[model samples]
Target: MASSSAATRELQKELEGKANDLSKIQKDISKNHQVRKKYTIQLGENELVLKELDLLSEDANVYKLIGPVLVKQDLAEANANVRKRIEYISAELKRLDSTLQDMEEKQNSKKEAIYKLQQRIQSLQAGKAKA
Candidate 1:
């Protein structure tokens, strides 16, 4: 009976730890998803800007906004920068999505472990009570 009680306590401790880990992982996943959404939106906006820039004449005045300054830049340079930014955002989105998938799988596995531990704890407690 004493051994059973000790085992139950240990399992409870492990359960608590797993639960904490699961919570932290879930929060990280949520944050990653939000960041991915932001990047996706930025990619779309950048693509739209690129399209508009393509429509403009080669000699059209293009100014890039620096910190508190509008720096004059060639249309081609500005277009190149926007295209690069779109590419970067798309890549980041892909990376974040893969990371999120891995985290979710870990979270699910932790949940399953927690469920199993809880069941074992319950059975131990029941046996202890009967004894």
Candidate 2:
């Protein structure tokens, strides 16, 4: 009976630890989702900028704003820079999405384990009370 009580206490401690871990993981997942959303919004804006750049005449004057000064830049060079930026943003978004998916899976597994531990603790407590 003493051993059973000890085991029950150990299990309860483990469950509490796991619950704390699950909470931290959930917070990380939420932060990642927010970052992903921000990236997604930036991607959309980049795409719109790309379209506007495309619509510009080939010989249109393109000036890049640096600080408070506008630096003259060739239209072709500006377009290329924008294209590369868009590609980079797209790749980052893809990576962030993948990370989010993995985190969610981990979070789900932790939740399931927590649930199982709770059930086990309840069973142990009920048996202890009856005894």
Cα TM-score of candidate 1: 0.97
Q: Estimate each model's TM-score.
A: 0.97, 0.92
TM value for model 2: 0.92
lDDT of 2 by residue, 53-82 (tens): 899998898899999999999888888998
Per-candidate Cα lDDT values, in order, are 0.92, 0.90
| Candidate 2: Cα lDDT at 40 | 84
**Who wins the TM-score comparison?**
1
Tens-digit lDDT track for model 1 on 20-118? 999999999989988988998898899999999999998899998899999999999999999999889988988998999999999999999999999
